[model samples]
Target: MEVGGSPTWSEPNGPPSPDLTSHAELPEKLRPKNIFEIPVWMGEPDRFCGLVVEWNNEPVHVLPFQKGYMIFGRDPAVSNTFVGHPSVSRQHAAIVWSREDRLAYLIDLESENGTYIDDIQIPLNEPVKLLPGHRISFASCFRRYVFIDQYDRVVKELRKSRPTVRVRHILVKHAESGRPSSWRGETITRTRDEARAQIQSYRRQILEKQEDFGRIASEVSDCTSAKRGGDLGPIFPGQNKAAFEEIAFRLNVGEVSEPVETLSGFHIILREG
Candidate 1:
């Protein structure tokens, strides 16, 4: 099945499942009451924006708001995004974009603990104008939500239809690596050139000698993923280091990469998706 714009094959030899679509109708009471309260699903030009959950000023999760209402709380049934904190309400808050003002607003749903913007609680059901960089929180929760006005929306739009890749890699860590410990709990002592040579040799084994890539990766790769045959899972855009992502995203499915250097070490990647 096509989930989140990607096809899923349930069986190893079976055809990919059919794409799924949402056909449920929105209830009238949930619809906007006035022209100024227009939802994003109504389809207006230039209305893409989002929120990012941050920790220590760095983004940890992205909450994209591109539809009617971006509801967030502990309840999956009512919330578009789920925040699993004990203090959070069932339906805590929502962010709504207005075409009339070309702006977004945060509305608290009379939550038990209350929704906070910049550490101050907002009035229940009132729309508070949101600005980029404003920190948001749920019921005095530890997680801080930072608002980004544009947030690379243009680049994301350009690549929205681009397919993401799943990859496995063999890493060779050198003495100078950011983390010089191997998956087997051994400290690395090889030089940078030595690591590069080792990675290149592994690539040669897969391409020329037709050696099993996963077996080699499981045996010698320095990454913790080596335990699972170096599987790094599906790589979405902006999910990994720039150097590694660049090489991984460019290779065709089933293709193996040359030695690619990153802060962690040298890697030989095999694209699987």
Candidate 2:
């Protein structure tokens, strides 16, 4: 007999099992919000301008924000056109336009080590947006001065013209011993150190395998509930690790992330909704 109208399989006597794979077919709901136009100082306002790594004036690497922030490389010859560096932090810098606040901020992601704002380091993971007159430091073999001009007039104009959007998300985790942890209200961390620390802690837990992240979860989880098998439900944007949140929000729903390490433990995230 045909199964579900397909001739290749036998029909079930009762209702057929729900298709688990259907979850995979669901469309992702999250969307990328429009930020703003790239500032003139970062690139050619006409074209996407930034510090780009080039070989003999031919573009090889494009620094996200290179105009406002300066970089020093070991070789001055190759470094002038393209911010030369051994790593992302040592070679990228920019003055960014913030979509949320409609403000122009400077970020120097290109440095031998990295740069910081208000004492918080930039670009170990993500880029920092600079504020007007904010101090920026650059490190190569030695320290150097970086400048961010006061452009409040432009910022004020942008803020008056652009509209802002409010995005919300939920984070889900398996409960322990049938008791799930209460949802912590949303938090927005302003400092880079605070964000980095949170991401680092989450990574440590995952590396240790203390939380039942499924698969190996049965073997190492401290939570009794997941002993039934770690099955965390739906997770929304901004719910977990900052690093994870940074990337996760970019993904469509029903996509499973490669194992992500967090302070709680390793996680195999499956976005439900």
Candidate 3:
């Protein structure tokens, strides 16, 4: 069975050895049978974020997130979140939470099996920003930890009245857009005409060829949301440019929009909801 990160209560040393003299003074029933019976000490965590672990649709463990960071690994001596698996390293990865930015980042510590976020293996040591409901996996372990943001009250508030729309898009950037740098940090040199043609071709594939929009967006979209199959989840009004939202709001669910030009680039939007 897969094991999730449980707090490392103490050093990796096995349960403390009982003194012979103390054992002699104790009653027979009180005498220790084995080290396995010894209890591991647990204390209240201080200044931890409200990170909850759920099992079978019920909250099972409540892990407090510290301000700086927390480690995940096999060796309890070095890791804050301990996964007792052979494939996991002693110091596997870390989750660094930033209070000011209200964001958490996952950093792989040059592990043997690597760390993954939503099935995507992250680069070693380079911090990848995490969003709420993102699934994290260490090594080849089957257990996945879902990153929960306790500070999503604003999103909950917005959902009350102003409903949001989910969308997937593919962007074809050109040098004429003035900002040709893609989300992947690559420079786009295509002209406006070239970009327009590329976007139209993608639309045709989705409309006529019945190709998967998400797969196409993940393969070619210039936006960071490409990592999430070009999903820009729950876009609220004013969160995106006027030109982009104009076509986005007008389309019915499951409808694909024609090439829409924005300041960033030419885009083909797929209304998901």
Candidate 4:
């Protein structure tokens, strides 16, 4: 397997070592993993002028009429009411509540410069639910999108509606013979010296073909694998070329190794173990 960051491949003077295995192999349990958590009102905009609350939440009062009216006011018992404020000239930022239902609400700050959600300008003193994946812009400033979970809570929800395994991989080449191998079920070196050299060489090759790999793989990889742009899978210790296997096993999951060289060419190794 390739080691080091250069294009040249050099075999170390040693035989391969024993294989290694990961401690955990099963997927995580299907539960709320708290993918998104932030303090309440942490992302609120400065000079705020709008308010957003779910129907179940208690009615909120907007004091002094910055740019909108309060819900359940004195005169009219309107469920959703809007009143324009002359002093609130700037368009207030939009607050988004992301949920499984894909519901979003936008409140326009009574401003000369209007508020646009997904490019559609909203009327002053009106509240509109933003469309899915819609962009919310106020006076041209982009406000952060607030994601709400299925329970109607204001926490960033994990998009686990659809889940799939995310795999990363590497291909190894023999340094002396220039033969290409899939690198799955093979032995690798664990020595630091050997791995260092192999990784350097592979890194160089990857840098050279980085653009090509992104483009060519999109067109040439097998249908089953092409969707990932030719990503094969994960490579672990003793699972790939000897030089690469050593370093690949040491990395944490989601860590990508620098390029290394083997007899085959250059390779970029990603740790998904």
lDDT of prediction 1: 0.70
Q: TM-scores of the models, in the given order?
A: 0.43, 0.27, 0.42, 0.23
Question: Which model is ahead, 1 or 2, in terms of TM-score?
Answer: 1
Q: Which is superior by TM-score, 1 or 4?
A: 1
Name the better of 3 and 4 by lDDT.
3
Report how far residue 188 has shifted in candidate 1, in Å. Answer: 0.9
TM-score computed on alpha carbons, candidate 3 = 0.42
lDDT score for candidate 2 against the true structure = 0.36
lDDT of 3 by residue, 1-273 (tens): 011234542223332233311345777787533211101111222233544554444555656665356677765434556665568776788776533234566778788899998889988865577777887778877666777764466445646757678998998889866256788888788889999999999899889867789999998999888999899988865456567878888999999998998756899998988
Tell me the lDDT of model 2 at 217: 40
Residue pairs of candidate 3 with colliding backbone atoms? 49-65
Worst 10 residues of 3 by lDDT: 34-43
Best by lDDT: 1
Candidate 3: C-alpha lDDT = 0.68
lDDT of 2 by residue, 79-145 (tens): 2212223342312343444332323344443344666554456663233554433444434312222
Q: Estimate, for each residue in 212-235, the C-alpha lDDT of model 4 and write its tens digit.
A: 443343442222344565466643
Residue pairs clashing in model 1 are: none
